[model samples]
Target: MSLNHVRPWKNIYRRTSRQIMVGNVPVGGDAPIAVQTMTNTDTADVAATVAQVQAAAEAGADIVRVSAPDAAATTALREIVRESPVPIVADIHFHYKRAIEAAEAGAACLRINPGNIGDEKRVKEVIRAAKDHGCSIRIGVNAGSLERHLLEQYGEPCPDAMVASALEHIRILEDNDFREYKVSVKASDVFLTAAAYQALADATDCPLHLGVTEAGGLVSGTIKSAIGLGNLLWMGIGDTIRVSLSADPVEEVKVGYEILKSLGLRHRGVNIISCPSCARQGFDVIKTVEALEKRLEHVKTPMSLSIIGCVVNGPGEALMTDVGFTGGGAGAGMVYLAGKQSHKMTNDQMIDHIVEQVEKKAAEIEAAEAASAEAAE
Candidate 1:
């Protein structure tokens, strides 16, 4: 049972939207909110790009987007698509021909701004290619790249302008009778991004791709994305998310999952609930958590662990997690398993011991899940 079941206020009521497929992964409706990231490598560099895509996929990316700026990149995209474990979305900009080439190259989806991809005739051709290749389209509207007319009309980029840009592109797809599409209205400003997404949510039933575009380096970008994406997600507005950071693409996937996990919208590895240590502590809470995080990265079964420095709120927090260690006197602390006080362990042995316990619990959960699935079959 989830904590949300007992606390109604914690529940998030997602907006109703039609579902679309990006390869085998579903976006929108009742689907698990998908996490996505783009490759930083040159698209033409098949080996490096493939390596990054595989790494992101192994880290839990639902989909990976690769830039296809020209013919050579689209040609290389063919190999990347073939090599990727997850779906590939070809990111096309200002070139309808590149969009067509990407669709024909076995891309599951194309991320393009319909307004900027030449005229209606070009857009129709791209849509035809998408339909023929069975590719879904993503209408990406960024604040930095709004149409010249929209800038003239609105005087500057704002939430209204971004939403207007999205709707205009959406109209092109709809005019062509193409419905297999998602849309994103993104801005670097968190406020503008949230407001634009809210307006877009009400204006269309298309799945929304959420992001705070060009969000700074790793630390600053993570903080900005978490605030912007977190609030929108809490409002039940996003279908898929990409964290745009000037960092490794794998970090984007990790941060996207972290945002979803914090909102209880998605669950992946261990969810550690730890307290910041103080003078009353009995163990090195910060160092212990850092070690546990790296050591337990391979545990995919969703669970919780609590590591508290002292008994202030230690025991109380332990009661809610799958495994816990609450610091105490005499060089040892109490260990709780399955939310109950189980035993005591010395500080020196706690890290390795907790890893073993988590692994055991994960295996048990997997076995039980397999049994339930087998019985259902």
Candidate 2:
């Protein structure tokens, strides 16, 4: 049962979009928004790139992208694609040949612009390669990298200019009879990103990929992406998302899931709801949360955990979460399971005990889900 069914105001009506496949994963339509991250390693080094892709996949990336710059990079993409747990998107910029190579190398999708691929002949060649190799294309238009003619006409990187650029790119693909593609118009500015994506959403029914390009470091980027992507997602404008942070690719995947989870759009792994520690805390709330976060990273079950500092709001918060711990006197805390008071334990045993409880709860959830699936089948 969905909470939105009871609270009508909490529901988000998603924008309608045609569905496409990035390998086995579905995008647009009723598909859960796919989370993506790009590897920063040199693509020529197959070992490093494959390891990075696997790490990001482990962190819950539905799709991972790698740069296929030169011949060397595209050559290595073959092995990387074969070994990757998730679908691989080959990022090709200013190189038509690289796009062809990547498509032949088994990239699930090719990230490129048809307008920039030399001439119409070159564009057709790349599109043909995509069709031949069953690769979908992503027409990514960044505000900072718009065409010179568009910049001249608009006199700036505005939403209108971004949308115009994306439409033009879309036209090239349409002209070539290619429709298996998704689109993204990204900018570093949150306002610009939101406006561009919203405009694009109204313009076409194609799957929209959301991202605020070059969104700073971990802290700043997460906030910017949350604000920009969050608003767009709330309005139901995005079909997929990538949190472009200047951090590890795994960090990007984690942030993407967090954004989706916050909106109740998608759920995977444990969702920790911890309060900001105050003087009322009976134990080290800050350190305990940090430890729990690391310890529970391996649990991919979708559920909630609350760690509150004091009894003031802990009980209320616990009533809604799957597992919870509220601080109390005498260096002990009250534990809640399935949103009900379960037990009390000293602070020393709390961390290990919570970890054990979370793991057990995750297993139970998985088993129930398996049973439900089997019963339905």
Best by lDDT: 1
Candidate 2 structure quality by residue, lDDT tens digits, 1-377: 11111246667889999999999999999999999999999999999999999999999999999998899999999999999999999999888999999999999999985436566678788889999999999988988788888889999999999999889878888998999999999999999999999899999999999999999999999999999999999999999999999999999999999998888888888889999999999899999999999999999988889999999999998888888999999999999998889999899999999999889888888898788999999
Candidate 1 per-residue C-alpha lDDT over 229-275 given as tens digits, one digit per residue, 9 for 90 to 100? 99999999999999999999999999999999899899888989999
Model 2 spans > 4 angstroms off: 1-8
RMSD of 1: 1.4
Backbone clash count for every predicted candidate, in the order shown:
0, 0
Per-model CA lDDT versus the true structure: 0.92, 0.91
Off by over 4 Å in 1: 1-7
Most TM-score-accurate candidate: 1
